[model samples]
Target: MKDRQLYQQILGITTPWFVAEVELDLEAEEVHVHLAHQQASWPCAECGKPCPLHDHQNERTWRHLDTCQYRTLLHAELPRTRCEEHGVRVVDIPWAESYGRFTALFERLVIDWLEAASQQAVADRMGLSWDEVHGIMQRAVKRGLKRREAEPIPYIGVDEKSFRKRHRYVTVVSDINRSRVLYVSEDRKQTSLDSFWGTLTEEQLDSIEGVAMDMWEPYIDSTKEHLPEADEKIVFDKFHVAKHLGDAVDKVRRQENKQLREDGDDRLVGTKYDWLKGRDKFNHKRWRAFCRLRRSNLKTSRAWAMREQAMKLWDYCYPGAAENHFRWWYRWATHSRLEPMIDKAKMLKSHLKNILTYLTHPITNALSESLNSKIEWVKYTARGFRNRDNFKTAIYFHCGGLGLLPAT
Candidate 1:
């Protein structure tokens, strides 16, 4: 049968019902669909009036799933209705919303592929522009947000990551147990956290028993202010604490290495140098240097002594020695003549409650970091997000764990 006749037959326009027909133009590499209206009247929304259908308008085409080698376009002759009570209005169709050219299924498919794949990649595969794919994703995000209004998230982890060379940072919050991002803010500030506080109630905050953070003042301040009576105790993650000490140790080691190089100690440059990496990864050579420094009894070897002290500080962090370790550190800090090391130890000991809590409940903000990695991947894959809403939508759809399929 001819394409036009086939389209008319499938559309069933002769019966004057509300349905659409499909026409496959194989030779032209196009599939055209026509939506027909059987009723010529619509009741006014504001005023009860049977509006008469005026005339068929221009063809509105929407991209659809491909048919074999041909691309499909859903074309409909949208009509305007003239009502006595209300002004001229566009007729509503059940297959697609007014002013929306794409079918619901087609939009879902595009958004699904976009959530799993990059915008550019989806555009390239579907022969669409990046803008179109992004538009679909933005719409999907809005829809998802509406559906997720009643979701209950108990434990949330918040952290920040640098973007655009550390000048611009984005704060990300995630569900720790579910391993998904709940939201992302423009800045890492207390105000940024305030944006989502309304999403949770006091009961929810009180339910949180633990919050893992990296010893950032803003996060700590915000949590305290927002959840003043929360049962959640702030746990300074062990990884970050260890990182701080490791960084300090590395700085000291580098200074020592620089001094050796300046003094023409080339014999101690290579093999002897590996001992100064960090206290955590200290080798046999490092242990030997530490022993030598502890036993040297030389006032000039302060750096070597400091390195030994740093090693001892790390040694106190060994597993299964929590009580003994705290006692040892307390005694060392109280009696030590080295004021600098003692000061550091005292500062750490002051937060011993949180530190010991970490030993017992070892939950970290690593899930938040992992979610940030995925957000970074989305940012890089798209090269950039021009629309903030679309960027947010993509993030929520991809990582919100709402069980929403891209095809939905």
Candidate 2:
């Protein structure tokens, strides 16, 4: 077969478009295929009304799939149509999308490579710059966001993650049941979460059964302002609750350790993890060692016990039973003679109404936590992002579960 015929078949050229010429430059190790239009006029891209051809656009070049060992490029002249209502615009082509510098097939290849590797790694492997690869990602995310359907999400999670050091953070909203990121915005303030709520319709917002998050006042205020019946729908995450308790216990340990050191007692030194770790986390020998530590009359022991008892309150099936159990633990915690425990107990009690809502929702930000772990990996893989927009784009591209390919 002739070279033009071979390239035409490989490119899948159909009517109204064909491979007019093929040039192989061995010195540059590139294959250039020139395309031509077969008709004098075509239908308007916007309204589908037939119009006369206006003129040929300037020569355009697009990177195509490599032909063997040579880099393949396509040269084309986009035909313009003079539409009466929509005015003159370039007609759409079959092989590529409008304003794109790569064929649809080549973009698909880039998307796959991006999913398998980091953006920088994919750019290095594909002989493309970082901006070119990121542009594809930007377009893919735009397409995916446009295609997402507004369905009722039964359970959702909202959390904050740092984009960089020095306390910079972004709020992330996710569909817990679907296990995908729904929205992301700068900062973790009330307005940051409010923007996500603004994206949902009234019906969609009404369909939300529960939202799991930490007891951040801004998030609470935002939800209370936007969502109907927000009291019942807001479920404080159990893990965040545990974190609070753990910090209280650690504080107790630190103060007691300082006092004991004055008296030459060193038992609490380097035993922070022993109190923080779950009871069963230690092996049999370590468990026995910790048992001896627990037997001592240590103030940290009382604090740790109170935290453990509070964690068990989550096992009750009904809110009434859970509330009763929590009250029992709360009384013990408040009276534990540790200032930190008293402070934490008071804080948790203030939010007790929503904390017990966990019985009905039984949902937590565990999935959101899991997604955050993946996001951390993404950041590490990229060697950290200098641009905040690029950081957000990377999260959506990797964790949004977006269908990020152009339709051919």
Candidate 3:
């Protein structure tokens, strides 16, 4: 086949465009393929109505995928058409999106590389600058966001993650049933989640049935403000509640250990994990050690028992039964003489309805937590993002599960 035909086939040029010429510069190790319009006049980019040729714009060059060992470039004369309805506008090209300096195929290759590797790695491998690679990613994310269909979210998990250090955070909302990130925005404030709710259509907002989240007031407030059935839909994650109880247990353990140290008693020494770890996770030796602690009169021992009993509250089939169990456990914890345990019990009492809402719909933020872990991995892989926008984009790109492939 001739060089022009080979170039045309390689570049996927067809219809309104074709590879008119090929210039192989061995000195520069580059392949320059010149493109030409097949017709003298074409449809307007704005209105899609065929119009007489206004004039041809200056030659524009787009970077293409490498040809074997050489860099490939495509040069074309972009035409402008004056539509009566719309003023003079440049006609759209077939092989590339408007205002893009790289061909669609090249951008597609970059998208695959970005999924597999970091932007820096891709830039290095492709001999492109870091900004160039980031631009490609930004454009790809824009395309993906545009292409994504906004379906009604029935079940969602809301959480916040640290973007950089010093308490910098971003709120992430995930479709729990679909196990994909639905929206992300800066800050852990109510406004952060408000942005997400604002984007949803009325039907989409009404379709939401459940939202699993940690006991963060901002998230709760946002849900109450936006969701019609906040009382019924809001579910405080079990793991988070368990975490508070666990923290209270550890606090009691630390205080007891300190008191024991003062009294010259070594009974609670080296037994931190005994109180925190689950009984099922204990080995024979650890179990024996925990048994000894359980039998002892340490305040931590009572706190541990209370924590275990509270975990059992989730085992009840009915929400009323669970609430009753929690109330009994709350009475025990509040009277246990452990300040931390009392505080945790009081907090749970305040949020009991949201906690028990879990029984009606057993949804957990496990998937959201899993997504946070993956986002952390993405952050670690990229050695941390310099800005919140990049961090948000990275999370969406990696965990959003957005279909990012370009049109063929």
Candidate 4:
């Protein structure tokens, strides 16, 4: 077959659009396939009404899939139609989407490579600029998010991810059951989380069974305002509760370690991490040493014991039993004379209703945290995004579990 016919077959070029000419620049190592349109009336790009072809658009080119190790490009002077309602608009082409600088197949290739490597790396390998690669990513994510179904995720998580240094953050809402991000907003503000609730339908909202999140007041207030029976559905993540207690134990250790060292009792001097570590984390040697420390009459030990007991409360299969366990644990901490433990215990008490909901909902932000780690890896691989919009785009592109592919 001739090169034009071969390219036509290769490109699956149809009646209205065909490869009119083919040029191979051996020195440049590129294949150029120029396209042309036959005499035909075309439908309006906006309203799909049949209209006369008024004129040809300015010549445009698209990066296409490489042909036999040679970079390929498609050049076309697309037809324009004067629609009565929508005015003169460029008609859609067969080989590429409107406004796209790359063919569908080429964009698909970029999407596949992007999932495995950083954008810069993909751009370098694909012979494209960083901005071009990012534009493809933006378009792919936009397509995927637009195509996403209105189905509600039965269990969800709302979490925060650090944007850049200096305490900047973005809120992420993920489908806990499927482990995909659903929404991302600019900050941890009440309005930030409130935006997510607005996207759900009454049916979608009603279908939501639970939301696992940290007890950030903004997030709590937002969930309460949107979800009915929010008390039962909002599960304060168990890990967050554990973090609160862990922090309290660390504070107790710091103060007591100073007092013990000043009195020449150096037992607590270098055990900062030991006190902070979970019980099972200790190996045999460290476990034996930690056992002796816990056996001592140190205020930090008592505080550690309270923290450990509170963590164990998560094992209860029933909410009532768990609540009772927390009450006993709370009483112990409040009367234990450790101000840090007392303060943390009181805070947990105030959020106890939602904390105990974990027994029934049995959901946590574990997957959200896991996805956050993946986002951190993406950010690190990209060496950090330039701004929040770019960062948000990167998050949706990488961690949203989106079907980010051009329809080739």
Candidate 5:
């Protein structure tokens, strides 16, 4: 079929709706189209009044998909309608909004691309400005959010991620089993989670069996308050628990290092000092000064012994050995002469109930972390969303498991 005939078929205009005959030029790799309006009347959008259509007010054209290197243009003539309530206003078409010239399907394509790709890239490829592409994304996000509000989630995993270089952070909540985000709040405070509590029904809150979180007290307190009967069992993720022990070990090592420096032990100051630093390298550089103390002439056999004992806690040979290992560690730590290590061991034993829960259900907040990564991607693509409503919608559409397709 010819290009013009094919374009007409794609538009699907027959009799009742108005049609425009336009000529498209793609020699310059840019859209150029001339449209002639077909005289027709449209109803007022506000009051559904059968208002008389005025003369063609203006001709607007938008860049659409390129056909085999040929630029496509959607040209339309906008007309006004005289409504007694709304006065004189531009008529709204089912295919496009009042001020918009592109068809609904065309808008959907832009939004889908925006979701997956960066705004600057989408704008350059579609021959549109960055603001135009962002606007379409904003609209799509709103529509998606509205659809998601119809259904609510039961089990939610709440966690926080850094938004800035320092301590500034944001909270994100997701469905643990479904593996989708439920909501994201601007701040990591209890108030942020409180704001979303209104959106959840009482039955939904009651259905939540357990909530996986870090050692943050605010999160635990808020969860308990909101989900009063929700198992009341907080599973402190293994990673966070391990991190605490690691920090304590480093602290003791630092104290021992200062005492060794007083005795002028220069041999313990350089490399080949793996024993003092331990295996975890996340904060190795910060704790290097303490690692040197391991070789100090000062009495540090107790500190060294505690470090080795702490490392042994992670040693689980098989599936059934976890309980036995926990019991063994309990006995060993309590009998130790080192007070600091004994204190930490006692704290661990106090939380043994929640710690052993991991053996029954070995799930962590890793799924929630994965969802936060996606949210970070969205923030980077748009360079941060100005509208909170639009941001929520975009998160829900992409991570809410709504299975929402683009407008087309």
Candidate 6:
């Protein structure tokens, strides 16, 4: 077969362009394919209007997919066009993306590998530098974000992830129903989320029905400032609420353990985990330790009971029943002589309406937590980023689910 025809078949060249020549350097271990345009007139890269050929630009080379063990390259001297409107500019190419030095096919492969591996791994496997791999991912994410669906997102989850020490954080706003990272900004402040809401259209803002988040005042304030029905929409996440309850129980355990130690009793020493163990989570060893505590009349034991019973508040099918149950539990906890538990009860009482919004929405920040875990893995695999922009890019590239692959 002719070299030109063979290259045309290999490179998927179509219409106004064809493989003009092919050169192979055995010593260099490279295949260079030259491309030529068949048409006499050149089209403007920006406007696509046919214009007179102004001049020939410098010959450019693009890295193509490797053929076997040898690197393949595409070389073309693109023509410039003098358009009446767009002025003199280089005409577009068929095989490579504009302003990119790599073929689209090569970039697509890089994107695919990026989904399964880190940028460093992909770079090492593909004989590219770390910056090159990062650039590929950044470009893919840009394309994906440009093409992202504009349909209304009703439910969302907002949270923050620390990318560096010293509380360097980014607020992530994610679609709860779609389970996709929709926006990321460089802080957990009200302005961080305000920036996200600022990008939304009035119709889009009005479409928001619920937002599940932790008890961060900034997030609550931002939602209230932007959303139409913030009171009915903001939902305090169940997991974060449970964490507060657990912290209160641990505080009670610490206090009681301190008193017992003063009384020369070492029974509660090294038993902190015992007080936090869930009712159904105890194994044989933890069960025995907890059983020992259950037999005692310790304040920690009473606090643990209150913590476990608070779990029942989420089980009620109706909002009114859950409200009544929570109120009764609140009264018992506040008067039980346990200051930490009483404080937690008061905190929950303050956010009681937002807590009950859970019954109406049934949405949680579970997906955001899962995404945070994946983001942590990304950070670990990459050994942490040197800056915030790189960290944000890594998170959006991996957890954003942006459908970055090019169309076949």
The candidate scoring highest on TM-score is 2
Task: List the candidate 5 regions with Cα displacement exceeding 4 Å.
Answer: 1-4, 10-15, 23-63, 67-71, 77-94, 97-102, 149-154, 231-233, 261-361, 372-398, 402-404
Q: Give the clash count for each candidate.
A: 2, 0, 0, 0, 0, 0
Over 4 Å off, model 6:
368-370
Q: Report lDDT per candidate.
A: 0.62, 0.89, 0.86, 0.88, 0.63, 0.85
Query: Residue by residue across 1-408, what tens digits does model 5's lDDT show?
Result: 235455655555333343344554546755444344454566787888888776666667755555556766766666788877887877665456545556576787876776678778888988887668766755665566667653445446778766534475667787888888777787778887777677776766666666777767677678767777533456667766666665555555566667667988544344324444445752767466555544454334454555566445445445357667767876776776556667778878776656655544455687566676787786666454555544555576567765344443
Stretch of 10 with least lDDT, candidate 6: 378-387
**Per-residue C-alpha lDDT of model 1 across residues 191-247, encoded as one tens digit per residue:** 777676666766666566667776677777787777654324677766676555444
lDDT of 1: 0.62
What TM-score quantifies how close candidate 2 is to the native fold? 0.97
Looking at model 5, residue 285 earns an lDDT score of: 71
Residue lDDT tens for model 3, 1-408: 248887788788897788888888999989989998757777899889988778889999999988877899999999888888887889988778998999999999998998889878888999899888888888877778888887988899998877668699889899987778889999999999999998788888888888999999999998999889899999899999889999999998898889889999988888877777776889899799779779888788888889889888778789888888987888898888789999999999999898887778788888566776788788887663678898878888888878776675
Q: What TM-score does each of the candidates earn?
A: 0.72, 0.97, 0.95, 0.95, 0.68, 0.93
Segments in model 4 whose C-alpha atoms lie over 4 Å from true places:
none
Q: After aligning candidate 1 to the native by TM-score, how far in Å is the CA of 79 from where it should be?
A: 6.4
Deviation from native of the Cα of residue 161 in model 5, angstroms:
1.0
Q: Any runs in candidate 2 off by more than 4 Å, and if so which?
A: 368-370
Q: Model 4, range 86-147, lDDT digits (tens) per residue?
A: 88989977678999989998998999998889988998999999889999999999999988
> Which runs in model 3 stand beyond 4 Å of their true positions?
none
- Candidate order by decreasing lDDT: 2, 4, 3, 6, 5, 1
Which residue window of length 10 is worst by lDDT in model 2? 379-388
